[model samples]
Target: MSSSERACMLCGLVQTEAEFVSKGCANCQSIFDKAGVDTIDCISPSFEGYVGMCKPNKSWCARWLRIDNFHQGLYAVKVDGRLPVDVVDLLPHYIPRDGSHVE
Candidate 1:
């Protein structure tokens, strides 16, 4: 991935850092908004495996990555990071799929 690209810690969606700062996470926007968390705090520059999901509902890869319900876009197979403690505290119902927290 390019240096400017970052993966959303909540959904693994990949986009430029600038885009993240401007738009927040496409899939988890409402969650972040409710938590009052900024996109910059929910993205990781270091992620592995790139996936271009065109049909999330039909793609096996998207299902495997737990992103089948999200919008079509570039995604990281695994995002490496954790949400800030304050953000987590604010989002008691939010379960992150970034591998930072165990289910």
Candidate 2:
């Protein structure tokens, strides 16, 4: 990953910061937009491993990573950093995939 790359804290979408700023996150965009938070607040440059899911619903790896419900794209196996408290509060049914609260 380059210095300009970032991963979404919730969905682990990987992309350039510029892409995030321009396009927003594929999975968490609406939530972040609704929260009125910037991409920096919900994205991190520090992450470990990445998986490109072509078939999220059928891929065991996607299921194991708990990203089966998410859209098909690049996902960080483990994103670093925590989301802001206000952002976390907005997600009543979301579980952190940032290696903070895994089953």
Q: What is the lDDT of residue 20 in candidate 2?
A: 92
Per-model CA lDDT versus the true structure: 0.83, 0.88
Summarize candidate 1's per-residue lDDT along 62-99 as a digit string, tens digits.
Answer: 88788899999998877878987766787657666656
Candidate 2 runs further than 4 Å off: none
* Candidate 1 off by > 4 Å: 86-103
Candidate 2 lDDT by residue in tens digits, 23-99: 98888888887888887799999998989999999999998888899999999999888988778889788787666
Most lDDT-accurate candidate: 2
TM-score for each prediction? 0.84, 0.90
lDDT, candidate 1, at 52: 93
Query: Considering only N, C-alpha and C atoms within 3 Å, which residue pairs clash in candidate 2?
Result: none
Model 1: lDDT to the true structure: 0.83
